[model samples]
Structures are given as structure tokens and as C-alpha cells.
Target: MNIVKSVLRATATTATALALLAGPCALPATAQTPARPAALAAAQQAKRPNVIVILVDDMGFSDIGPYGSEIPTPNLDALAANGLRFTQFYNSARCSPSRASLLTGLYPHEAGMGGLDSIVRPGLGGFQGRLADRAVTIAEVLKPAGYFTGMAGKWHVGAQHGTPPKAVGFDRSMFQKGGTYFPDQPGKGRTFVTIDGRQARLDSPEVGKGEWYASDMLVDWTVRFVDEAKVAGKPFFLYLPFTAVHFPVMAPADEIAKFKGKYMAGWDQLRRDRFERQKKTGLIAADATLPDVLPEAYDWDKLPAADKERFDTIMAVYAAAISRMDKAIGTLVADLKARGEFDNTLILFMSDNGGNAESGPDGRTGAAPWGGKYSNIFVGLNWATLQNTPFRYFKHYAEEGGIATPLIASWPAGIDAKVRGTMVREPGHLVDVMPTLAELAGAKYPARFDGHDIRPMSGRSFAGAFDGKPLTRSVPIFWEHEGNKAVRDGKWKLVAQFGAPWQLYDMSTDRTETRDLAAAHPDIAARMTQQWNDWAAKSFVDPWPNKVDGGVIKGRLEGGKAPGKGKHGKGKRKRAAQAAAGA
Candidate 1:
């Protein structure tokens, strides 16, 4: 039955891809059914093309220019102009969970990544960084298929040495043990770990110089890897999870200058302008109502002179970071085209999570607690609101602003340029990437590997959508990271934060989630809540076993607290010790 299903799926996919290539054609016998391509049917399948998954950190749905932000993301805009861009995609509400699900094709908890700031420790059950040994990563699965896999940028899933990218199957890796940026650190000057069996810090002092932009560093490495792979005649998997535009707002001074006075309009006017652009560009539907402007907590007109100056500087720096990242992406794409590998390479770009609102309305300007080495400054809620544009809440919540992200997939060989301007409204999530990539690569997903029983991937392949076919998720999608829970079935999404009442939305009509349908659809809400609970239980979602004395977990800048001080103090201390030992 599985084999039969697979064959039918392949046939349908081929037809869809061909139909896209042939332009408009007569409707198939069933309007809902996909059309198969004759060329794809006759062609013998070749080895999988190289996969480049570029995951950016803390980017909002509308932060990119194509998505209606004022930010100049020309590179991302170009990708949208030439490939498939998704409008109704979702991700876990926060970082680690999103990365975990993207890599393992399972909910974060199911993959042993369920909380924030929890480093993964070896031999420790239910801690972050543990990839459930049972779950197979894309790198591991692709290794046997003869693909050279490499990853750079953030690796938040685990900080333990043994579980770094190399252990999971990457032949090469240069990644940050945690999500951070440090322009002052010595050597790679960027606090990063290089894993090729053993974790070693890169000893390149050039990394600390003001001239080094982390985004460019990652892209340079990617280009080198691509060149090497081509020379070796091998397909490669380059997982570039960039930390650009995250926080401590660092970017080239020139990039920062481009937007010097751009954000003088403040978030209020900036958000309004972005919404208008979204409507004009067909990024959002014409009838879609613009969310009410967030009420001003502080009267900007009445702000003290010093306060105003600080606010403006932070916003400007934040914008600069985004612009610089965009420029770097353009460079990477250009390199691919120059190398003649652009057409066939499948490029997937998305954010690890939504815009961060942690800085509050006032931006944070100080050395990150882990020391100024990891970050120089932090942008708070005021800028976060602009980043999240047209959505409510921010990172760490299951609201649209937190989980919704722009997903761009570009491949000259697979996607139709004519459809480049179109948006796929079908609801997709991070977990879907694994299966989608597997189908595209014709890679097999094993039931068991490395002496552990693997859980079947909960995500269904979305390759069908590339050809304009509707994607049917086999299981209701679920999420449970740090008590931010949600369940999506069809167009309806049910969600709740820790200690909050469950809220529901009809994603088709209310993707921004301004309306709470829980009151109108009690029965549907009940079903979704029950499903979320069931899935959460199966995935081992639980609150931290210990509590901070004042609900304060020490910040890394303040010398992160040792494990086991407050509630789960022992657990925390043990994990910290393991992290120190290079677990």
C-alpha cells in the first residue's frame, strides 16, 4: 500500500510540475486533481540536486521587502520574483523548537527540544540539545545517499559537543553553539564551534575585525562548499542558518547609513505603510482588513530628548542589520548563478522564528549578559512591532506575529517564474520541510537508525504544492514549545500560551488572528484542544521541574545561573556543567 501510494504521488507530482512549465492548459478531468507532466514521466530520475536551506533568525513575516516591509531586502525580493513564495506558512513560536522540527520533521518536544535557553546535555533525559537519537536528521538521511552535508551559522538544537552537527551526519560544520553575535571575540572573533569529529574554535582573528559581517562569512563558506561539491561531482546539502538581523543589531556601517532617516516615521507610520504596500503588491488580499495600530504605550511626542535619541538609534541599527543581510544574500545568489549552478539548486529561505519582542518598547543597549562577546545590543518591542507588521504579539507566543513566516522556495528547474508573483495560501509549517526535501531528493526515510527506533515523520511532503496541487496533511499539525501550544486542522488553528485561555482562528479568513473564533465554534475548538493535549502528552511536554526563586533565570550577561538553584536548579546546574565540559 505504501509503495502504491508513493507511485501515485510521484505521478501526480510530475504532472503538476509539467503543467506549471507548459503554462495554462485545459483543466484536468477533476479540477482538484493535479496534472502529470509527460517529460517527467519519460525521464529517468537522476540523483538529488544539492539542497541549500537558508534559515534566518528572528525575522518577521513582513520584514523582507517582498512581504511589504520598508526594509530593502532586494535579494529576498529577487527570490520571490523568480520562485515560489508562501504567504500562509507557519513555524514554532520560538527558535529552538522551530529548528528542531525543521531538522527532524517532528514537533519540538518529540525531538527533545521543548524549552527556551535550555542547552542540550548528553545522557540527560528530556533536556534541550538531545535530538532523541531515535529521530533522524536530514543530514543523516542524506549521507547514505552520497551527499556532502555542511552547516554554518546557528545550531541551537544542542550545545553539547557530542551532538553537534558532525554527530548528526554533517561532514563539515562551523556553527555557533548558541544563538549569539560577537564582533569583539578573538579568533573567528565570532564565538563559533567547528565540528569535524571534534569541536574546535576557529583561530581566525579576522573574524573580530569590524570589516567582517557574519552573514558574509557564512555565505563565503557556502560558496566554497558549493564549488568543492561541484568539483567532486557530488550533490551537497548546505544548511546555512544565518544569525544576521537577529539582535545586538550589527551590520556594516555603510548598510546602516542607507536607512539613516528611513525609520524617522516610527513604527506606527512604518507599519501602516507596509500594510498598504502589502495590499498593493497582492502580498495580502485587498479585502483583508489592516490590524488596528498598536496603541502607543509612551507618547512619542512627549519623550525625553535622550530617550528619543536612543530609540531612534536602535531602530536605525536594526534596519541596517536587515539591509546588510539582504545584500549578503544577493551576493550568495549571484555566486551560484556565476558558477552555473543556480538553475538546478533548490533554495529554501525562511526564518527560524518570528520577530523578537523581548526588548520591550525601549531597545536594550548593553553587552549581552553572556558578555559583550555574544551581542552588543538588543532591539525591544517597539522595533519588534515594526518587524512583525500587521500581526499581534512577537516571538515566544503562538500568535501570527510569533509563528507566521515568509517561506520562499526557488528553483529554475522546478518552479515556474510566472507563478513567482503568486502566493501559496495552503497552510504549511516547518515540520513539512523534511518530507518535502526528501521527496525532492528521492531520499528514503528509515524506520530505525543508529540503534534507536525512529518515529515516523509527522509532516507530509509539500512537493505537490510546487505544481499547484492542494496538500493534504495526514495528521493534524501540532506544536508545544515552552507551553506555547497550537493545533492546525484544515484552515482552523487553535492556540494558547502558558496559563492562557485557548483561542481559535479560521486561518483562511483571519491569518492575522485578530478574531477569536473559539466562542463561535465551540465544538471545533474542543476537538482541536483535545488533539493538542493528546499530541502534547505523547511528545512529553512538561513545565520546568524547578522554578526560579523570583521567576528570574539569570541572564547570560549577569553570569547565567548555575543549574539547580531555583526550582529545577539541579537540572539546570548539571546541564550548565555538561555545557562547560563540552558535552
Candidate 2:
């Protein structure tokens, strides 16, 4: 909770310190990244070959068609079919942190959003939910390098009380600051669509009486921006974070009907079906086994007819949402192809994290969390367990199911065709995104931005893998969301739930984490334990309080001056006086 005046400047020795902490920068394009194509000169790359990062929110490992879901995601599937699908990619186990890491090129904690923008103080680095000035976003980095950056959809990384996307560097944006299942839903509509700095009222026309859906709105804005970029003939960096397939599921009526009874077969069979498809598609080994559902759901057949019907419709709605999102993307890609930008566009598709098992305010009180009669019922735990398929657990944990994300990279002009439509299993994480894009765009991650020296980005460039090169990593990737912690080094991964002992597994063999080798390999466990502890200490890890202990719900930002206790009160009163005078 150490909020203070924004002055965290790095000293003259920052580069040396950051370099030491960051180890080595993954450069030269040959050892780590793919060698640059001779024909695609830096000048040529400097202009065209746009970058499009499509972020899917709260999606599971096996949700889309390419990832072995029955849901039709032809556009996403085409990305996998024409590009490279990653069999072992990772997210930061939740929404905000993942976005923070993806955009910042640092660990989420380094970006000051170790958690959502909920601002729960004194609970580790997560409570400070916004992009720290030091960790400049890709938009920030690329803009000065001459890329027109635009963002659409979720901006959960900084809900409000932080530097906005435009302030951080997006030139134009159509950002729905948060999300709504339907704009017409009661207590809905809170999008902030801006051209430059002026609000365009994409939130609501008159409040609760409109034809608006988050997914469609995002696509609409994205298309408009892309068209503008094309007209301008500038290589644009489009970060379209989709709010689809999350919760309070809403879709067009026709799309909803298309998925009616789709999940009537129930969770049991759906899990097996998706897993088998994954195996066949070579996304997983043929011998991969379906994990036993955690908490063990009741048999679908044993449920009452009414209850069964409810569950079926719930899943159907979820599937329909995905289908609807895919269709919108199809329209976008079609538009891109028509505009002749499809082939040259570097499209990266990713999910924030695995399936969600969260029960929103609607479930808790029979009313929407925002105090509305909303029908966007959470998918709940049973279906979520199935959503994760062969993986275990759900979002918010450092398990495979929580952190694993489906990543597809499509670039007709860049990715080698021989590797197109293939799967790359070399492990990578969200932190790799900024460095990868920086290398691709020839953009420099500044040593300094806004008075603060950047923490040297803690990711090896994975651009080398674009040309079918095996992605290599010399350093272990680490994770800590809430108190859930883990460390992945090479083939061995040591994971643990909050307040639990570490469980070691050879991930190359047990990617599903079906067996724990910690008991057998005492020495390895002890060594990795120390390694994880060192990582935790260096990575700004902090103590997380358990709710049972009754930690403070919210507290003053740490290191901030006391409200009326010093000279701070004068500023607050001055601001209040200005507002009182209508200024």
C-alpha cells in the first residue's frame, strides 16, 4: 500500500543494476530469436508488417477449436492452421497480471499489477493494480518508434486510478474500461471510447436501452482503427483484448440458438471429447489422460431434469459466446484480407488464463455484482473443471490449468511456411511478449521513460521460434499470484498452493502434474525451494494475508502522506475548491 507521489527515478547506475538483475538481453537474432529474413530489411519492417495481438479473456486451454473444443472458432482455428500453435505457453494465472506481463515485458509484479485493480492493500504486490511508470507498455515503446498503437476491449490492468492507455502511449483507442455482458442489461454500460482525449460515449446512449455487446463493439472499433491505419499507411500495433467467453455470458440470439443442447452430453463426456481431440490434433501426447475433476462433481445423469437443463443452457451460452467472438474475428480477418493487410499482419492470439471457477455477485446474492438483475450467470466450478480438460484446478492458482494459455502466432510474411500449422512445445510465458514484439518491430525498450529507468525486461525473445526454431530459455520462469507459487526450470517444475508444501514434477513427462516427485527427489526439491525463495525475494514478493485472519479490506497507500497530517491536506482542499467552483 505504499502509494506516494510519482517519483521513483532510477539512478545513473540503473542500467548496470537492471542488467545484472535481468542477466543477459536475448539479442543478435540468431542465438535466441529467429534470424531476420534478408529480404525483409529493417526499413521495410519499419513501415509495414503490422502487429495484431488478440487477447482472449478468462479462456481455458482447450476452449477454441484449434485447442480441441467443439465450439466453432474457425478464425482462431485458421490462425493455428496457418501459423504456429504453442503446446506449452503460459499466462500469469489471472486477467490483470497476465495483461500487465504481456504488455510490460516484465513480470506482472514488476509492472505494479500483481493482481487486479481491486486495490486490496497490504496483500503482496498485487494490490497496486496499475502499470507502473517504469514498466512502459508496448504501446508506449512503439509510439515513439513511429507505430500507430490502438487498443480495444478490456483495460482491466488499470481500472481508473492510474495512467490510462492514451497517457501511456496509445494514439487512438476504443477501450471499454471494463466489461458488460450486455449494454442493455441493468447497471451495465461503462465503456470509455475516445478518439484522442475526448470521450465518445460508447458506454451508453441513454443507459440500459441500446443494442450493444462488448465483443461486437470491440470488433467494430478495431475495424475502424485498422481502416484508419491502412489509410494512413502506417504500420500499426493493434492490441485487441476480447471480453468474450468470460462470464455473464451474452451473445446474439441466433448464435445462442446454434449452441443449444451442445453441452447436453455433460461435463464428463465433454472433458474426454476435448482431450481426445487434443491428442489427435497433436496438441497433447496420445497417451495423455483426462484428469480427475477436483472437488468431484456429481454425475450429470444423477442431476434433476431441471438442474440438468440449467447446466446445459449455461454451457451452451458459454459456447455460443466463443462462437460469436470467433465469427467477429472472422469478419475482421476477412476485412484485413480485403484490405491486403492480412498476409503482412503479425497476429498473435492468446488467452489471459485458464477457465474461471469464480462465482460472481449474481450467484452470491441472486443479483449481479453491480446490483442489477443481470442474467450473465457464472459458469460455476463444474463446467469450469471441464473447460480446463486434462489440466487440473482453475484460475488464480499456479497450476497447469490456471496458468496454461493457448497461443497462436500467425504471420504469413514472417513465420516459415514449413512450420505453419504446427505446434511448438518449448515453454514460454506472458512476459516474453514485449521482448518478442520489440525484436520483431525493431523497437527499443527504452532504458528510461518518464523519469524512471525501466527494469530490464525479464524475458528472452521468442522471435527465433517464428521461423520454426526451437525456443530456448536459460533462466527459469517463476509465478506467484495470491500465495500460490511455483518455479519452472527446464523440464522440472516445483509448484505449490498457498500455505502448502512444494510438489515437484518432471513437466516433460507429467505436463498434467499427475505425480509429485518432491518426496522422491529431496535434494532437487530443497535446491529448487531455495531457488524459488531467491526469486521471490528479488521479484518483490510480499506476504499475502488470509481472509480468515481478517486483514484490512482497504488501507491507505503505503508511504503516502497522512491525509490531513502534513501539507497533503492543502492539495486535497485545493482540488475540492476547484471542483466546487465548477472548474
Candidate 3:
């Protein structure tokens, strides 16, 4: 066995490991447990633990303290200190697609979301820009199993497509389109909050006046929903997807002040610092090597003092956003403990995608917070590189930096004591969430529901990992977004940029994907590509549209709603350099 695996296994006793691994670990198929009788389900619900899935937007693998960042995330760090952390967990690499896959146990395309909900393509089921009716959400399945489901925060999956959280199965929800953090902050689009199922005020007294923060308000409603569940005497399933750390990143002035001057060392030094910390934490393999910085990142020493100072404030704001979210999580965990639900409630925290690099190297900024044109404020490619740490690329690509997410699972009663504080090296994805919850909650996954033929889940349960056992994936994992495509089978990964030839890498040896082995291993590349193509066809993945405009293209192309003064190509770089010279 590999040293890392052996170390992980050693966390548990020989007897415990043997007994758990040898026990019956079969996950129930849809046909096997179609529906439990109402009485039986009610009785089982008493014994079932509450489940809470907390997802953050556009966060990187190393942003939180557990994943090796300087950012203060004592709440998340505390969870990992007493819980299990997966070293290799993945997301769908974007917002809508990832949300769709996470809610339903199918690929984004299979769930009728191949891209952002903002983009729609006619006659294409995959590009329908909505969550498909054929796929059932976790809330939908768990509700029938006697679980009281509630959601708070962003619900971008199918709100525009006429399927809100309440429509899908959440008993209660408080959600919006999720752009602004402060209630008074002006955004280009009007984001209205929906209470339960009806349209409601975004700036309600519940959120307060000037003190209203999105993260705080979201959790307040979550606590309210949990109170309702406790009153009903049903096991709860709560989903809290915060819009923190995404573009137009904002936090309280004092919070932002606390992080000012913390990132003055620049991206080069910060990236190295995070990489070393990640290796020391055993989050990556011992032999893993960091790749060189991308050409898009500017040299820190060469930058003007004014630009550096500005960048520092921008990063401080970014870090403040994460710190604020972490604080909110602390509040939620404390609430759970106070309610006597912390021990049994399985809290799974993760990100929707990797760090966002949408607005180019010098990210867009402006008076959007006070009511100017909505400026998409991001940390730029250089800072995003540091955020992703040892991984290459950022959000909107199939690379590790794009999809790799930090997944922390904590359940004092449900998880084995021996595995606590240990790292699970099992590679898992968002699809696995459904089956994992199903097995843990003893929920029956139905073949059909609500007069519709529901698609069978494409996920395998990773619940065995709670006992320090391997969560073996029988099939390969695949990704396709914005023309970027990739397929990973066992140790081999074949990936390609939009309109580019495939490049293969042996993931077992190089998870960072620095060296391409396509020329040396043609057979493996061909085989995996074929496998990806087959899966894509079945999953309703549409062909590349070959269209580009004022939208996200592929690779190094910088496109978003906040283009700022930076365009693409030499002109963008030239302008940035000229501005730096003036600065």
C-alpha cells in the first residue's frame, strides 16, 4: 500500500478497520428500495441524523485554513480538527452546473444544465439552462424518506426555469439571485428574495437596515427553518449555499480592515506559502510538485507601489469575505450545538467551483457598492493562482484548479471516532453526495417519482470512508463546460481546452497535470477520449457551439459581465502595463 494510504489507515485500529471494511457496505439501488412504508419511514426517521450541506461560491481548494491558507477560518479549521477531510474532492467547475449535479446525483448535462443559467440554447436539452425534471433533487428524495428539507441562500439551478427550491421539495427556503452582499449595495440586476415559495422583500426587517449582510441573513433563516423542523419532530436536511468570495466580493468595513496589508507579499510568495502548507498538511501526495506560475500573473517586484497597495486592499476584501463566511459557519455550528443537533447532524462543507479568474489579471473594480454600474470585483488571475495554490488554471476549466474543492465532513455520532481528524484520500465528486446521504439516512431512491420517469443516479456512495475504508468508484469521472472537456479513469486523465487537442496526464504521479503524456501513451488517451465521448452522448452533452462574444470563451480568454477596462489579447496587457508605468 502507498505510504499515504497506510498512514490514513493507521488512524484506525486494526480490529476496527477490519470489521468495518468486511461489513456489508452495499449501497441501495433505485429498484432495490423503491419506497419504505410510511410507518416504517417515520420510525426510521427517529433514528436518522439530520443532514446539512453547506456550499460556498467560487472558493478555491486552499482558501480555508484547513486547506492551507493564511485566511482565518477557525470554524472550518475546528471542524476539520475533529472531522474527516477528503484530499481529493471535486465540483462541476461552475455555478449552475455544479449546483445541479450536487442537488441531483447526475452530471450537469444529464440534469439539464450544461452551462450557466444565464445562457440558453434552443433545441438543446443539455443547454436548456435549467434543472431537468427527469432528475430528482436530494431534497425531493429525502422528503419522501421523512426528512424535513430546507434551503437558504442562492438557488440558481432552476428558478428562472419555473422550478424553485420549494417546487423541488424543500419545505422552506429563503433565496435570491445572489449578487449583492449588503442589502443597501446596488447591483446591475434586481435580486428579489423569495420566502418559502412567494416573492418577498430583499431588505426585510429580518435582514435589518445597514447592518444586513447576506451571510448572516441566510443563516438566520436557516436557524428559523431548523426550528420549524425541530417543532415538527422530523430529521432535517438543510442546504446553505453562501454567495461569499464570488465576484463583487464585499464585506463589512471593519472586517475588510482586519485583512488589509495581510497580502502585501504578493501572489508569487503567497502561492509558494500555500503550496508548502498544503504539502505539510498531507492534503497532496508527498511527491507532488508545484507548477510554474502562469504567464498571466505579473511579477510582484516589478509592479508599481500604488498598484501593489491597491491589489493588497482588493485581496483584503476577498479574504474578508471568506472570513465573514467562516464566522457565519461558526454561528451555525454553535446554533446546532445549542439545539443538541451538532453531534448527529452530518455537516458537509464545500465550494461550488475553484477560484474565479473571470475579469483578467488586473480585476475590475469601482463604485458598484454605492450604486454605480455593477463592477464585477474579483482578485484577478494572479491572486486566484494563489487561492488555488498548487493547482493550475482557475474556474471554467477542467483543470484541478477549476474543479478541486475542499470538502470537510463532520458528524460526531455518525462518523467513526477513530477516523476523526484523519484525511481520507478517496477521490470523490459532487455526484457522490446523493448516494452518500441516501445510505446514511436509509432513504430509498425511487426509480420514478411524481408521474415522471426519474433518471437513475450516476453517483456511488462514499459513506464507507467514514470508517476509513476506500470509497471505490467503479466508473470514471468526466467534465465538460464551455467547450472544455476532460475524462479521468483510475490514474489517467485526458483533458483538452476548447478547440484544442487532448493532453493526457498520469494523475497518480502528477495531480497538478504539468507533464502531458499523450504522445507517449496514445492508446490510453484514445481509450479515455472514447469513454468520455460515449458518456457525453448519453448525458445529453451538446457539441461545442464554436461561438464567442462578450462572454466566457476558453483557456486564457478573459470574459465576464465585469470586463472593466481590460479586453483580451495584447491590447489588454499593453494597457495594464501602461497603467502600471503611470502608477
In lDDT terms, which candidate is top?
Answer: 3
Candidate 3 clashing pairs, residues 3+ apart or interchain: none
Please, what is the whole-model Cα lDDT of each candidate in the order they appear? 0.66, 0.70, 0.77
lDDT of 1 by residue, 211-280 (tens): 4667787788788788878876768888999876666556655666666666666666777888889889
State the RMSD for candidate 3: 10.0
Summarize candidate 3's per-residue lDDT along 1-583 as a digit string, tens digits. Answer: 2334223222322333244333222235543123223423442444777999999998999999999999999999999989999988899988899999999989999998888776678888897777775887898777755678899988888676656776677778888766668765565443457787677556667544555788887888888888999998888999999978767777877888898889899888988888888888888777888997665566777665877776787888889889989999999999999999899899999999888776567665665341112445667777888889889887877889889999999988867888899998867889989987877776656666554577888877777777676666678889998787898888888998777799999988899999999999999999999999899989999987653323441133122322222332222232111011000
- Arrange candidates by TM-score, descending: 3, 2, 1
lDDT of 1: 0.66
Candidate 1 TM-score, C-alpha based: 0.82
- lDDT for predicted candidate 2 compared with the true structure: 0.70
TM-score for model 3?
Answer: 0.87
lDDT of 3 at 246: 69
Better of 1 and 2 by lDDT: 2
* lDDT of each residue in 401-450, candidate 2, tens digit only: 88999999998888887888888888999888887877766565777765
Query: Candidate 2: deviation at residue 474, Å?
Result: 0.9
Which 10-residue window in model 1 sums to the lowest lDDT? 574-583
Q: How should the candidates be ordered by lDDT, best one leading?
A: 3, 2, 1
